[model samples]
Target: MRFSLTCLGRKKPRLLASEILKNVEALKTPAKPLRSQEAEFIQAPDLSVNPFFQQLPPTLANFFKKYPPAPFRKYADKPVATNAEDANPFLPNKNPVTGRYAAPKYSLRRQSDLYKAAYRFGIAHLLPKLGNNKKFYEDKHLNKTPVRGSVMFKLTKGERTKDSRIQEVNEALSKADEIIAEHRGRAYRRKLERKSQQTTPWF
Candidate 1:
C-alpha cells in the first residue's frame, strides 16, 4: 500500500519482487467507482494538462509541440513541484458538496484505471487537431519551433532544486504511509520482515 524509494547514489530503486507480487494481488479486484452517480452529471477536468507533455520546454512549442498545462495547476509556472498537493489529480475543485475541498465522482477515479481510459480518449481526439495547427513559430526547413512567452529552461530547473520540491515529496510520502497504515496490515508485517532480514547476520 505504501511504497518508498530511497535514491541511492542517484539510482532509483526498483520495486521488490514480493512488493510487485503484492501489487498484483491488490489489482485482482479491479477498482470500481465508489458509487454510482449520474455519469453525465459529473464534471470532468480540463484535459489540457498532460504530465509528460506539459513538463517539456514550451520554447520548443510547434505544430507537433504541444505545451499542455500541468494538472492541478493552471500552468507549470506555479511555485510547486511535480508531487505537490496541488499536483494531485484528485485534488477537489474549489467548491465541494461535503467540505471546502471535495472532488466529484469523475475526479475521484483519477488514480484508477477508468481515469486512464478517459485520458487516452481525450488525447486521441486532441492530438490530431494539435498536429494540424502550425501557429507556433518554427523554422520549416530545420523543423525547429519556438513557443511564445516560454519560460527559460534554467528557471524551470531552478524551481526543481528549491526546498519546496523536497518538502512536497516528503509530505506526499507521509500521506501515502497514513493511507497504507489504515488498510495494509499484511504490508506492515512484510515491511518489518524485510527490515529484519536485511540486518540478520548470516552464519
Candidate 2:
C-alpha cells in the first residue's frame, strides 16, 4: 500500500513551478530611484542700476528716479512756468497804446472785496427792485433809487441827471480805491508778521 501511495504521488503530475518562477527575479529588481519632485529656485539678478536710466540726461534721469515714468509721460505736454508773472497771463501792465497803467481784466464774478464795493456803490442803482423790501437804515440796501426806471429796464428820461450818475460813479471808484488800499496795507502787515515769526527762534 505504501508503494501504491508513492506511485500515486508521482502520478499527481509535478505542478508548473518553473513557469511561476520565471518572472520572480525580474520582480525582485529594485525600481529605478523615483525622480525628485522638489523644485530648484535660482536667485534673480540684481537691478540697482538700469541701463536705460543711465542713458537718459542727468536732469531727466533724476526726475524719473523721483517720479514714475507714466506720470512724466502723461503731463509732458503741459506747460510749466518757472515764475509767478509768467504763470499769470493777465498780470497788470502799462498799456502801450494808452500810456497808462491798466489793472488786470478780471471777470466780475471774482470774489474781491473791492469789486463788491464798486458794484454796490456804482451799479446798485440800476436795479431798484432789490431794495423794495430790504431795509436801508442799517446801510444794507440803497436808501433811494438813484435812477428812475423799472427794476429791470432803464428809462428814456430819468429823474437823475447825467451829472448825478457821474457823481455816483466817482464815489464808487473812490470807495473801490480805498478798499484796495486797505487790502494792500493788511497784506503788507501780514507779510511782516510772517517774517518776524520766522526770524524768532522757537527753541
**Candidate that would win on lDDT:** 1
Taking all chains together, each candidate's TM-score versus the true structure is: 0.15, 0.15
Off-target runs (Cα >4 Å) in candidate 1 are 1-161, 171-179, 190-198
Model 2: weakest 10-residue lDDT segment is 123-132
The lDDT values for all models are 0.45, 0.44
Q: After superposition, which runs of candidate 2 have C-alpha atoms over 4 Å from their true positions?
A: 1-48, 71-203
Pick the TM-score winner: 1
For candidate 2, the lDDT comes to 0.44
Clashes of 2: 0
Q: Please give, for residues 74-161, the per-residue lDDT of candidate 1 as tens digits.
A: 3222223333344322233333334354342223322233323324445322222221223322324457455755644546766868
Clashing pairs in 1: 59-147
TM-score, candidate 2, is: 0.15
Clashing pairs in 2: none
